[model samples]
Target chain A: MTVLVTGVGVVLPGGGRLADLGRTEAGSLEPVDPRSRINRRGLRYKDRATQLAFCAAEEALNDAGLYAPAAEAPVRAEIGIVVSSNFGNLDTVCRVTGTIGAEGTLAASPMDLPNASSNVIASSLAIRFGLAGANLMLCSGATSGLDALSWGRRLITAGRCRQVLVLGTEPDNETVREFTDTPRMLDGAVGVVLEDAGTAAARGAVPRLTLGTACRGGTLADCVAVLAAHGAPARWYPPEAVTADVLDGLFPGATRVDLAQVWGASSGALGVLQCAAAIGWFDGGGAGPVYAVTGGGRDSAAGHVFTAPPGVAR
Target chain B: MSAVIAGAGAVSSVGRSVDDIFTSLCGGRSGVGDLRVFDRTRYRAEHAYEMDDRPPGGPDVPLRTTRWLLAAIEQAARSGGLGDDLEGVPVLVGTGLRELRSVELRHRGAADIGPADLHFGPAVRERFGATEIHTLANACAASLSALALGADLLDAGEADAVVVAGTDMITESMFGLVERVSAVPPDRVRPFDRDRLGAVMGEGACAVVLRRSADARPALGVLRGVGINCDAYHVTAPSPAGMAAAMRQAYQRADRSPTETDLVMLHGTGTMLNDEAEATALTEVFGDRAGRPLMTAIKSMTGHTSGASGLLGLIVALRSLHTGAVPPTLGLENPVPEAAPLRIVTELVEGPSLSTAQINAFGFGGINAVAIVERAR
Candidate 1:
């Protein structure tokens, strides 16, 4: 069973859609207030990271034509969600932690306690969207976003769910900045709607691209070796740590595109953002077999191969 | 093919080794005591289940969660006979707070926090030489989710052996949060008791080395399947329907009927709503057979270990399957009305010849995960 990326949504700096992913450089892009993009009813108590997730999720659902009126929402339990974020809700967690440290633990509001949990963003998204499928939250360093996609694919192929919303988001806040040291900070969310190809066809939804071989390993060489099993990639989206000389040695003929340089440090959003960029490349008449690899400056890395779907003009 | 538990390790407040913990549980000993991890005078309740074997430097140490995790992993590897080197094998960690306690300790002028300590990936890499790592924070159901992912990796031929583990340290913030939220100050965790107040916080780490059944190694038990789902209901509150659905899903994936289940490890948190809801879920899933499955809530003695609770309960259930001696749910003098439809183990049962067991783990955000395990034939 093949998995298809049917929808793409991102809350990047400036104003760039799925088509302008690689071309437009997000230069010190300021975060946008999610209240303007999403419903304001449930926006009061949610943290900024969750609110950003909501914005990106709304756009992705709308793009997939899966967004329905509240009263018209069909059985939502058939859909699942996988979220990847390392520092998305650290601001809230730190604030609550600090409040309990300064004042008594009773000082922290009951409303804010839920946000202290690492799974808050994923759970909040599920509650807001009424998705009851196998929900998961991944925070496995830089390759987290790719791990989320991998899990989403497993959930679909395992028949746990027909469609899974995979989200990768990060927020650059005071607390996150204190804990993290990155070349560039990102404050945005990227979402993709992954559906079983058969389910997509039955729903009359056009797929952006077909997911291909995916691999994760302890080192860049391991991932590269496994991802190269099918054939040499036409284009390679390399991690920030991989230089042109290394890429040349590895892929040789393939073009190297670094999205981290295009848009600041992606953190957990690296892999999903890379997939969104691949979707844009395919839409712009790019060729097939593009591999996006990310190693969050750690010993581990995750990579996925994206191929243009059959019948798509290359 | 089912994934076999090749080796297991655990370090909870009750005991350090799995055998010791099982013995403590069977002896009906309660680990709950005065909260010493933090200043307890500020809270209404001074009692908690704190680990006696804390690493050197007391409670204000950095990498507290990492230390516990590495200890458990070491024990798991040693017992599973996997040796010290785990070079190519993948390690999946399920943690609710991860190193939040460490981060909190850093605030009070503790050792400088390393970036690698924030997630278990770097530490696992450094210690075990594991290249591929996944850390999941699926609330309290985190470990079961990791176990499920491990099973999936085995099923897909991704790894011949995978280490699935969960660890969490009770932070002052979390301890205080529980204290402030409970309807009444919880003096003890009385799961399914009519007068149950709320859950007390506990800290520990547990790990299991999973290998394919075809490995021809000694097996603790066979992990049949794990079912995970979100209630999407409420953040702090659980949904009985969602809980039942997760259990039913596990049974279905395990290809076993509820009638075949001889033991059930309940996710009874001793909270007013959680216990009642769990009882309701049991009734819904088992129907008339709910009373047939012998059930026990280990939280009554271990307290709530957060993410580590799932694996801790699983270790108990596996031991039960092995020895036919089930642990008691201490302090269950009077059963709640909702529990009337089920068989609650008030004292240890030494004989049942248990073959199959189901472990339920429900977390905040309505994340529910249930794992099915069977004795090795």
Candidate 2:
């Protein structure tokens, strides 16, 4: 029941290429105006995180050949979605709550209230894409991104959907910065389309990478151990919170790629961004069996093992 | 491999424990009352199912969803005869609004709610000593989804025992949104009622300890199967087709027919669209057997507990199986015409031998989750 990662899309700062994930810093990049990239018809009421997600999802869906812009694509009930974000709609929620606190409860607009829902970002993607499958929004602390991936995998493995869209988005704004303790937060979204092997093969979609073994627990060490049971990783993308010395003790001799140094604080988007980085590394002719682990703070961590598929340019 | 409910705990407006809530429901006691949690003078609707008593928690746990969650989990563990230390047990928390009330309090300088508190994983680990934690924000269907995931984890041998919980508190933000949306707020929640105005919000927390049926522990009930789906239709609207699809999926997974279900706990938000959609979905799924299952809507008594409502409904369903009586759906003076094909339990119906029950939880964003549970043989 192996799931294939057929598409990778990112709305990172500075228009960074996915191939240059760990090789370069994201720089002092600003958020991209999603208005230029996506349709503006339904963008007015969408929160920033959701807008970024739409941008990433469009690219990922197109890359997977499942969707095309203005192509009158048939609605797919077999495509599900899983979203991971801790502060996706913080600004919208704060605005609504602030309005109620300052002016009366009646002051908050009903139109903007839907955006205040924690699952708004995930739901918005489902609505725009006509994906009627299982939709879940995970805010499971530091490992949320990986948690989302796990759910996506489950959906496919359980035969609930043939392909699942997994997005990890965290919006950077004044409200999020004020409420969030994580420094250098990622300002955009990262999306990866996970398809069942049979479906991908039938559609002739080339896999960017194949998911190996993935596990999560209260700490990074626990997840690493679970994945390590399969095989030791050649390269490891450790969370920014984890220092090289600690990772050296955990996975000795493995090349450590600190993603936070490249793309700010990943927060909830850590796991998907890590997988995207792994795809980039593999595309760069890196070796197989890479481990990407997110979470080192007080919350739980998730480690996923991925390998370049056969004939993936070696 | 089957997953059984080892223990259950709850804190609703009518009662604190599962038994108390069941008794209150059987007696048709409504938890709806004055909305004193916030100033109600400014809003058209002034009543909600607000909790009168606060549960104690560790200093690290804030006093909103986290505190209630911890209390519910602790009660669940104790009732299941577990020791003080949960050790390696994994904890899953589901919520529509995860600690937004605490965030609002922090905004008003009333409390110091940190970013970590927003996600219940760290707090769950700290208080329960559980190494693995997952927080799901699937809106109203969250808790049932958690239950489904928990069962999956057990079936996958990920954990020997898992605790799944859901909690939400009435926030001024949500109240404001409901107020603005409702044309006229109903004095009380009246699910399936023809004259039902709209739903009133409630605050509560509920938890269930789940273990493999092979554990040989005394169980409250068995989770037969769960089906989840997203309508993708509208943000605020429910789809009858989507809801029926979920029920069919659940029945398929359970390997049980719709006719086997003896009771059904309706999502029944009392909204015009929600009630109509649910009734239509039930009719579509059950067909001529629509009137066979004894249907009850607990929201009429518990008000809409939001994320916690699903687990709360589940607890009531399990209690009904044990007590051989279905709780009444209060305020159902006139059944909606759409629900005529379906049998609505308006009064406490006793002396019915029940074995299987279905619980429906539909949330904003068109998220629908249906779980089927059967009595432990």
- Give per-residue CA lDDT, model 1, range B33-140, as digits (tens): 987767555667788888856555565567878888998999898788787788888899999988887777765666588556778998988888888888899989
DockQ of 2: 0.69
Residue-level lDDT of model 2, residues A124-184, one tens digit each, is 8887888888888999877888778888998888777889999999888887778876556
Per-residue lDDT tens digits of candidate 1, residues A1-314? 89999888988766556776767466546668787787788888888778888988989988898876443464388889999998876776667667776787778777776887889999988888888899899988888888899999988887788899999988867677677766556677899999988899998998998998888877788888888887888888888656776767877688887787777777788889889888888888889789988883564888899999756866
Residue A232 error for model 2, in Å? 4.4
Number of colliding residue pairs in each model: 1, 0
Q: Score the docking of each candidate (DockQ).
A: 0.65, 0.69
Backbone steric clashes in candidate 1, count? 1
Candidate 2 Cα errors over 4 Å, as ranges: A68-74, A225-232, A243-250, B54-62
In candidate 1, position A115 carries an lDDT of: 81
